[model samples]
Target: MIGEPMPDPRRSIIDNLNQQLDAFFGAGKSVQVIPSGVSADAPFFGTNSHQLKLRAERDKLAPAVRAEAAKGVVASVAAKNLRMHVKRVTLIAQENGFRFADNP
Candidate 1:
């Protein structure tokens, strides 16, 4: 087992993000419906155990690998934000009587 190669840490984070987004927004639907009069101003970023583990393990990697890992984290966060924004925009547009082409 000692000879087994470990997986890239960034891939795990990306997978986790994708799973969470799918669970929230559903597969293939970038946007979700929010009931009338509900506000959507929740913040996205949070320091959690997963991040702490990444930070700890990151210190052990080479500088070049660490840099790449940081980029992965940034990209993952951006993708997540984009997904949430789609949901928010859809909810707002719906409240204003605009229907999505595919949804309507």
Candidate 2:
């Protein structure tokens, strides 16, 4: 049994961000639209050098994707931290039986 609360807001926020990323990257669809005449196994390059070049390009772009994902993770962590701080403050006030009454 994990000693954590159920439905953790942080996890939910992260999950939402990941879903948005999937939509952004089009992970649900084909990477490239193949023409009707093109077969799935068709080679993208006639030479190994061309294939290696494409692979290198993909590797270069991977870092940017990771950076974006890191941003989302940071945001979710910040939100969770803020929520926890607020909850602690509220608990402290409740324990002290503090009350605010506006008087004009």
Candidate 3:
């Protein structure tokens, strides 16, 4: 219990981001196709959660996602930025059901 180390929240957030980027990033904004590979917008970050373990890894994805955005799509977002954006979006998703000290 006390001796057990808590898992990284960044890792958790990143996993959830990958899972929900479709909804969070908005429709028709995916940069890459996934799974079936039918050349459509999907939320794959050009990589996986393991690669997203550090700040450098998170920052490394910015350009690619931004490039997609420049092309009117959003394929892969960086982890930290993605995490921040996801929080903001989910807040809206919950219809302002959640709050924090900063918001209060």
Candidate 4:
């Protein structure tokens, strides 16, 4: 495996996004991550129609909803570091406007 090609980081991020969304929204929800390169056409991470709906619903709730969502996202990414070569992970909670303590 010395000369094997490294996995694409974008693909890894997309896969992580899908798994995290499923865990947050339950098994049957449709969630996908579309990766576009470092170009202007790249879409924001969670701006799909289904995600828009979920965000709208969450927005209607108390401020804690946003914090919880951020925490979940950060936790999901951090978990991936266990099996993958994650260089860094950062979690920013919008409610308190503070970042999580980095473990690395």
Candidate 5:
């Protein structure tokens, strides 16, 4: 496993959506995807018998979302076009689940 690259985090749906909301409205404006009408572990079951919800964070999420990117070291790549980025992670996840869904 030496020299193997670590998985990119920005490619995550939730992270992208959060960044989008933040880019649109500024930090703390980001939202989180929570399990709705379903247990927290429902996604592990591979069942469509659950629901997901997007909720705005009541506290500051800037640190959580921007820290890795803002760090001035080699880890700073996240701050770049990575410049941009989930979710509405559930909605996107659903789209991944049901690919035929319309974007609009």
Candidate 6:
């Protein structure tokens, strides 16, 4: 196996996002880590219009609805001790009234 390309040890952005989805949907399976500098164009499992609807509706919601949604997300994160650092960071951001760049 010498000089053969070894698998990347780092996770990719898509994998991280899928893990978040899995976690949100009750963590059925773990995401396989893809190596850095690798490209994976595969679609995710359990991806559906409902997820898209939720994402779209989030932006159209009023400020109060958004705040309530943030609270709900924070409450869920607080209730479950998610191992991902990004999830914890998201919880922190939610508590601090900040959001991911994708959010409105």
TM-score, one value per model: 0.26, 0.23, 0.21, 0.25, 0.18, 0.22
Residues 1-104, model 6: lDDT tens digits: 99998765565667888878978768566668989666556446545678677555444433533454455554344334333345445544454576544432
- What's the CA error at residue 39 for candidate 2, in Å? 22
1-104, model 2: which lDDT tens digit per residue?
68966898899999999988889788566466767767756665454677677556545544433443334443234225444343433333333444222221
Worst 10-residue stretch by lDDT in candidate 4? Answer: 83-92
Candidates ranked, most accurate by TM-score first: 1, 4, 2, 6, 3, 5
Q: Any runs in candidate 1 off by more than 4 Å, and if so which?
A: 27-104
Task: After superposing candidate 4 on the true structure, give the runs of residues whose Cα lies further than 4 Å from its correct spot.
Answer: 27-104
Root-mean-square deviation of each candidate, in angstroms?
A: 26.3, 30.8, 26.6, 23.4, 29.6, 21.8
Q: Of 1 and 4, which scores higher on lDDT?
A: 4
Query: Taking the tens digit of each residue's C-alpha lDDT, what string does model 3 give over 30-85?
Result: 57546665544554764455644543543554444444334432222322334546
Which scores greater on lDDT, model 4 or model 5? 4
Between prediction 4 and prediction 6, which has the larger lDDT?
A: 6
Compared with the true structure, what per-residue lDDT tens digits does model 5 show for residues 1-104? 99999777767877889878778777445556866676564465443443322223312333443443234322223323233233332233234332212221
Regions of model 2 farther than 4 Å from truth: 1-47, 73-104
What candidate 6 gets wrong by more than 4 Å, as runs, is 1-42, 65-104
Pairs that clash in candidate 1: none
Across 1-104, the per-residue lDDT of candidate 4 in tens digits comes to 89999999999999999989879789567756757555466567777789777556534542443453346444345436333222222222333344533442
Best by lDDT: 6
Model 2 scores worst on lDDT over the 10 consecutive residues at: 95-104
